[model samples]
Target: MSVWDSIVGQQAVVGQLQAIVSGDPKALAQSWLICGPPGSGRSNVARAFAAALESPDRGLSDEPTNITRQVLSGTHPDVTTLATNKVTIGIDDVRQLILTSEQMPSTAPWRIIIIEDVDRMLERTTNVLLKEIEEPSPHTIWLLCAPSAQDVLPTIRSRTRIVNLAVPSTKAVADYLMASVNPALPAERQFDRHVAVRAARLAEGHIGIAKLYASDTQVMSDRDELIVGLLGLRKASDAVLLADDLIDTAKSQAEADVNRQTAAAEADFRRINGLGEQDRIPPKLRGAYNAIAKKDEIKRRATRRSRDVLDRALNSAASIYRDIAVLQNNAEDAVGLINMENRTAIAELSARLSRQEVVDRLEAITVARKRLLGNGNPMLVFEALFCALIPGRL
Candidate 1:
């Protein structure tokens, strides 16, 4: 697809970028602060902009000399994209971009640099970038994507043009899904507009999760289990099981990552230092060495955050149950959960749990999330949390 066709429902962003690429992008439209909830089109917008800026001669191409395709493959000489993959984009990365931007593009129409998750950029790095943005090169355009404009520093926001992309309408999403799905599936196999809308709304503008729900029964079941587990009796067994599941997930990710890095580094080291009197120590081993050197912090953060993700799933379920508890009170009216299927247990809990008890437990779940982000103890926090939520054997 041409650059503009990729953004599903955002005509304005598409138009704005087209104009900019056609060399009439409004002078006022520098440094766009594209913000949206996670899974939204934030990164896509930045990518689209980069594609436009790096457009190769569309009508006439030299077989393989296309800048747009290059940018798409993440190999464009003049376009640099940074995301969470790099632990951090130091002042050096930004400074290098500044230097690259100053030099004329080797191939692309213009120099486009995309800083994804701009919020993750350290303050010092952000400061270094600000200098470049303040007086950017004529051929350079910086596209910054953040979860919220507020996520970027105040001073940084003040200097840039802001383009707020709204969540796609449900009708838009439903229509898009219809086009994306297979036609061979019977009409009865289709999702009604209502189901598509619910999935889209809950997804908060992420087409990926919306697609997951439509394509994977497992995803839907996972969501259901997550909600139900939270509201169910806080059994000691359930808490332990949940924590163990998370522990496995986190450990598996870390070990697999270490293994992949170790293998790649070892190969490169061996290739460079062939046979006689060569070094056996793989270069990639250096990274593993550094990681083990910081084992305390790495293990601490990963274990806690994984548990937090698990606990948050449980807490959401708990909230579902809590609402039902409130409902049994029947105070005037309640904003109810139409999706909540396990209402019987909710009603039973209402009779047993005091309002204060429900509220406090919810508060504890929130504390668990904070502690996880701050790198708290995984087992202790969740274990104690379960003890609080679960009724004790007196």
Candidate 2:
């Protein structure tokens, strides 16, 4: 009946975690890897362990004493969590996490650190982390989560114990949705159900994604339609329109992201210039011009990527519909690389296309994705993809 019990379909993982809980978790080696598919509760399970280790049940009390409250929150002696706030977790952040690992807890009995999306850590970050993992820290523990065990470095993986969370079934996802949504919601309304269903269908056992899909059906619908359209290889007018839509959207996202990065860079630049005015500017600050230059470069890359993302989004939209077309025609399973959302549509479209033709369409979409990421011209990529999708039609 502990908090760990709530995790669904992860019996083996739960057993392992429970054993770790029963033993001297603080004394245990400070490193462990929790591997699971997306939405499989990897982070949740890890957090639950951190909470229990920090809990009063373990006899340690790192109580939270705020101005207004006593946050008995996981009263464990020492626990710190690090994760990606940006799109990537670079080396600097990982270095900070490692530095903190060397410190003694301010209050908690045991020191625990959780790194979510450990796979997202850049190469430099991972390299810095390797040293910390290799060293000893009796009171400190590390929990890293990733899509798979292979996602991390061999040295890091070899040193740590591993726990794999189970992928819950659709029913389990649905049941979770039933319990997780707002209770005040009208009984007849199936908003949560719709989301859970879509996530279950698309994410294919990713609880995080299922919840996301369930939480925002409209967005999912829009995303699904977009993918469907792109893959289906619509008309020239449609392609132009899709390209325009993607370009506009990418422009906005790129600008925003660039602005944020630019602002951070400019702030540092100003601080450096001020220091120089007072003759306090260090070599590092003076060298920060390179940093500023790099920021601009990254902004430009992101700007370019925005266009690519828009194109990919459209391609994904087309693929979904193409899947429907093929599925309807009794097309071979080979074409349905991912979830087959519209079986009826696939069956219907299959009537018009040969099995090879449907498979070709799917392949075209895949090629489109690769081309975009590889800096393949989007206009040309989309054009080629459309031509292939439509066959003899121009």
Candidate 3:
């Protein structure tokens, strides 16, 4: 399939990118910024654009050529990608990428450097990158991806041509999920239309989360448990217990994810160094392994990842209140509901709580997210949030 086919619900942006690749050489910019919300396929679009730029026919062919495949797999020598798992991209990483950007393409028409999570860079690090973007090499191209253009410095934003991507419609997401199901799997294991639609709506236009919800029954069950638990909250004691549960769950999930990534990194390092799984590392190679797998950085990343997990939960919690507000205001048709499967519970909550109460709960969720971002204590933050969510407490 064409590389562009994997890009979901971004026809307009894809068209713009294709035009740049096929249009006059003078029209091409050295730097480009792709901005979108989480799970909106920002990095996918960047990779596709990189592939198209490097393709012999500029991705005009129906089938992706060898060069396109290499770029997408991140094996292309001319394409350098910086995707950080940590909360921030370090200055040293960006400096190294800058040095790479100066070299011309080995074989492809243009060398591409893709930076995912450009928004994670600090001001000082962004300044270091700004100079390179300002004076990019003729054969080099920089593609930066972020949740939004405002996340980056104004200087970097102005220097790059910006491509803004919107969230795909719920139906689009559902259809994509349904089509993505492997026919080779048993019917029971495959996602049906109903499951696809439900997951898509629950994800609220987040393709990645929708896929997770569709494929993993556990994810959907966990979300249901969380929403049901929140709606069932009736007292301060219930709030405290649930808050603790939330913290524990987020920490456990984050640690599991971090552990998996660390294990894979170590395995890859060992494989590259020609060491067996059971082989002892040489003293020289131990330092190299330690450099790549820093214990301190892993701990920091786990903390941040846990905060991210909590933030997603906060978003889901807010969505329930949003649904309740919609029902209370009789704006169901206009605003629609995210948690439609919980209509009965939502209706009960709507009747029990005033519109103002629902609004306050939503505001509290917003505040909790901000506090989490500001490095507030998660346990205290969630405790205060859950307490604020008590019905009629506001």
Q: What TM-scores do the predictions have?
A: 0.67, 0.65, 0.85
What is the C-alpha lDDT profile of model 3 across 93-139, one tens digit per residue? 99999999989899988889999999999999999999889989888
Q: Count the backbone clashes (under 3 Å) in each candidate.
A: 3, 31, 0
Residue range 255-372, candidate 1, lDDT tens digits = 5445555555556555665623345545755564455436575556555444434543554445554575557567315444434466676667667777777777777777777776
RMSD of each: 7.8, 9.0, 3.6
Best by TM-score: 3
Provide the global lDDT of candidate 3 against the true structure. Answer: 0.88
Give the better candidate number (1 or 2) by lDDT.
2
Residue-level lDDT of model 2, residues 228-342, one tens digit each, is: 5554555677666665555655565566656667777766677746743335546766576566657567766685657634543644555454555545655646544344555
- Measured with C-alpha atoms, the lDDT of residue 262 in candidate 2 is 71
Model 3 TM-score on a 0 to 1 scale:
0.85
Which portions of model 3 show Cα errors greater than 4 Å?
Answer: 181-188, 251-308, 352-356
Highest lDDT among the candidates is held by which one?
A: 3
